[model samples]
Every structure is written in structure tokens, then in C-alpha cells.
Target: MKYVFDWEAFGGCLGMLVVLALIPIGAFVVYFIFNAILFILPAIVAGAIILAIPVGLFYAFKEMVFKKVE
Candidate 1:
């Protein structure tokens, strides 16, 4: 008796296994990215606000001091 190997079926099963393996890895990648953005967004916003306040005050004071009365 001789046995025959089916390349097509093997390839299909291999592809399915690879796809299944990637699902968890892809989920973790997305999860980490989302968490990182959430963690960093507040710091970015706080820094922007902190920098803006000083610049805004300087501009406000400049306008008040330099404006001429008509």
C-alpha cells in the first residue's frame, strides 16, 4: 500500500494556523497602542496648556502696555 500527501490541504491548514496565531499578537499590539495613547495624551495636553498660559499672559500684557488710546 502507498500513501499520497495532499499539498493543497496541508497548505490550507498551515495558513489557518498562522492566521489563528496572529490574532492574539495583533490584539496585543492594538491594545498596547491604545493604552500608550491614553497614558501620553494627558501629559501632552497638560504641557501644551502650561506653555500656552505663559505665552498668553505675555501677549496680553504686551497688548495692554503697547496699545495707544485713540
Candidate 2:
């Protein structure tokens, strides 16, 4: 006995194979995006702290050292 060629079934199988191959590539892209977010969040927090410290010190000096004048 001989088998017949089935183009539809073959095409479906090929499509599935391509989808399976892409899964890992998608995962790598997602992983890098999360890493970029992780790095950016810390830099933003550090920037806010760096800005706050100066303003806080100025207020402290005005309240403490200049208390007698006011």
C-alpha cells in the first residue's frame, strides 16, 4: 500500500513548528524588557533622593541656625 500526499496537514504541521521556534525568542525579548525596567527604577529612586537631600539640608539650616533672628 502507498500513502497520499496531504498538503493541508503538512502546512499545519509546519506552522506549528514555526510557532514553537518563536517561543524562546519571545521569552528573551520579555526578559530584557524587565531587566531594563529594573535598572531604570533604581536610577529614578536615586535621583529623587539626591534631589531631596539638598532641599532638606537647606530647610534644616534655616530653622536651626537662624532661630534667634525669627
Best by TM-score: 2
Query: lDDT tens string, model 2, 1-70?
Result: 4345456655655575466456545555655777766655555555565576557546643444332321
What is the Cα-based lDDT of residue 21 in candidate 2?
52
Residue by residue across 1-70, what tens digits does model 1's lDDT show? 4345456655655575465456555555655778866646555555565566557546654444344444
- Candidate 2: list runs displaced more than 4 Å: 36-70
Q: Report the Cα RMSD per candidate.
A: 29.5, 31.2
lDDT, candidate 2, equals 0.54
lDDT of 2 at 43: 53
- Top lDDT model: 1
TM-score of 2: 0.42
